[model samples]
Target: MTLVSQSNEESTCERPTSKYAQYTGVLAATLAAFSIGTYLSWTSSALPLYNKNDTLSVSDQEGSWISSLVPLGAIPITIPAGMLADKFGRKRTIWAITVPLFLCWYIIAFAQSKIWIFLGRFVAGAACGAASVVVPMFTSEIAEQSIRGLLGTIFQLQITAGILFAYATAFTDNLHVIAILCSVAPALLLISFPFVPESPAWLVMQGRKNEANDVLKHFRGAHYRTETELTRLELQASEMREAKASIFDLRKYQKAICITLGLMIFQQLSGVNTLIFYAKKIFDDAGSTLSSSTSSVIVGAVQVVATYCSTILIERAGRKLLLFISVSVMATCMFTLSGYFHFQNSHDLSSVSWIPLLSFAVFIVIFSIGFGPIPWLMVGELFTNNVKSAASAATAICNWTLAFLVTKCFQDMVDLMGISSSFATFGVISLIGTVFVSTVVPETKGRSVEEIQIELYGTQISSIPRETDPEV
Candidate 1:
């Protein structure tokens, strides 16, 4: 059966499509991503404070748990989060993220013991996992096809901003103060997101044509042709319903599934999270001239700037190209870090102490531009509506599961194999990731969902002509 049918009639009068509402909605949805970013990076800054505080008295083992718990907490919730987004609607599922995020900070802000602190971190991670599944779906569904890549990249941008926020707040020695500050983004999201429109795609999936039309009109502005878009949405929705997709049906879309899951696996294996979760510690261990907090703040700022550059370049550079460059450079940086650590084990390299800081800065910059955002962005682009939820859940689960393994095992790997060997291991994995991107990954830049499917399956899924924007 055809996906979206072509329309015979053309509008004699065309009005300009305003993107302000779309941007507003996307910004609001991505606040959840921002909150999750803060939680992910919280350990980098907070762990040190935990050790210094006489009241908390957290050990190295407990610190690893705190850093790892976020991803660990995410695993079980990912499948349920996908189901919730599909069943309850993306906006509602996103709104629910604020509850756990607020509770996470609140619990940590007043915790009297290690148990309370661990509980808080896990709760925060639950919010992180849920947002990972829902925010991308919400943003992609609401965006105009022309600007969809940019909007999708914004989720990662906000996440970088959140990481920067967490690092910046590390200046305060008071952990309670940092927790309070981290709560601000979710609070703003809670206050502002209610004004944003729901996903038109989700509305259409529920057979609410009129409401979908209204949401489209709101997003696209008054002069936009809502009916034509609505027809396309309806057709796609009908196709999905006919497929009756479930988790068991995933084998039918194996290539897309493999690509998405492989990207996630490589993303974690590249050791980005190990650096993010322990940025301060890594710098301190490297014997950098800069203080650990200062080094982390610099890396965090670089991350934000690089991710911003990515939003501008994504559609122009294409996904595969960026991934290739990103992974290649990352592998190089990992090898460079390994060499630095090897020499440091044998000699006092105070003269060349800046190597670790410089290596990680370049690594974070390259990572933000390519590997950091593309996997998450592709998650929204790679699958059909029928299996999208299931694929996203499975992909997220793989991502967090690997993240947990790498972050939890990083120090152990260092102790067992030495820091140089540990970094060399990530370098090899990243080198393999470069090959995976070059050979296996498909480019989805500036393409509609149906066109992407046609490329993946080698069959034309729709007869509908792709909509064009002269303004683009």
Candidate 2:
């Protein structure tokens, strides 16, 4: 990521050359590590109680804060998670979380009491908070400027894939099935710990300047980024040298704090986690006895595939364009499902049954390709290194806080408003999300971090993009 500063050149927006494949491999490992966040919480959907009774006292909707609770649980942990990544190497922070993540799932699998479940979920969510900070920071540091959007999105894409995998195990009553399945992710991630290198930026931060060069050898490909690139990274790290914000502090980076909150709140408003946790029930409402677990699997699979396609297409289409296409499709699907449920009521279930299920499946596909992957990508890239951690924590708070509200209210919403109206309400939210993405978001497709700063904060676009691509 050589910053061609004076001329305002952005990196060549070209796709990765064949050499970036290794970086892509590292991206996969980081993605799997990152996905423990989703996998840990997603298992709540398959709770033995929820599968059968779903009684108010046991698996009741009002009682189900555990699903979204972790994201909220994760809030207090985010700044520390980020600081750890900045202070220690990202791999170290990520590696440290792996054990707790595995154990939390195990406890959830076996826990007999709600107290135990809450504790387990709280712990698991904390691990996710750590991951949310570590993975993107690591990815951004390692990925080519040319492919950052695509690389950045891999985290979300894999998260969708993890959900699909979790839903795939929907049928079994045994907790081990879910536990062992979720455990497999961290187990694999643990293997990458010994092999993958540390974040170059973190190394530079620790004043291991000479050691930073060695790690950079593995992280960067033969097309050496110019000296200016290294200098910019060092300069960014220097700004943070004396800057440390405690978990209790929020005043220093107020703008980042607001944006983080907004990003998380809006991301949840897209109704993604609600749809995921309740995909089966939503299908059931639409007139399909298709086993809630089965519906989950189907939705999960579609999301996984759609996200993969997002990675391939995000660069070609540009971030804003892809987001518009995805949000439009999602909004359409939302309205279609909402109307089907609204009109159908309890009358003649035979008529409106299939549309909601079909609509939901379509919604999953649309979301993954656009809104699902893009939100996290944007949030990760939105903040500069200085406030990135605090911002991520704040956004995470909004994400989980709304997630808790949505998860807790979903069944109540179903009980009060009926399925159709609830879906309609969500559809309207998607339209709002579309509006926000269009007017507020800028094109950061191939921009350097500093260049993005200039564009968003009125600095200036970098020179790389303006300078002709040698490959072209």
What are the clash counts of all predictions, listed in order?
A: 0, 12
CA lDDT of every candidate: 0.86, 0.66
Off by over 4 Å in 2: 1-34, 37-45, 48-57, 220-235, 239-264, 289-291, 349-352, 379-390, 434-472
Best lDDT goes to which candidate? 1
lDDT tens digits by residue: candidate 2, 1-472: 3456633432432222344544654554565444553553364456434456433135555345666667667767776777676666777877888778778878877777667877888888788777876787788777667666667667776677677777666666555676777777777777766687777777787777766766655555434443555676688777776664443444533443454455455556766667777665566556664666776677777777877887777667787787777777777887887776766653676754666667778877877766666666665566655455565566666665677678768778877987677767877877886777677677768877676656554653323232255753
For model 1, the stretches where C-alpha displacement exceeds 4 angstroms are 1-17, 223-225, 377-385, 438-472
lDDT of 1 at 95: 84
TM-score of each: 0.88, 0.79
Per-residue accuracy of model 1 over 1-472 as CA lDDT, tens digit each: 1322222223422232698999999998888889988998988888888878897888877888888999999888988887788798888888888878877898998999999988988888888988887888898889888888778788888999999999888889778999999999999999898888789999998988889988888998877788777888888888877875667767667777889888998889999999999998888889899898899999999999998997777767999999999999999999999999899978989999989989999999999889887887787787766667677678778999999999899878987998899999999999999899989999998887777877887764333232343542
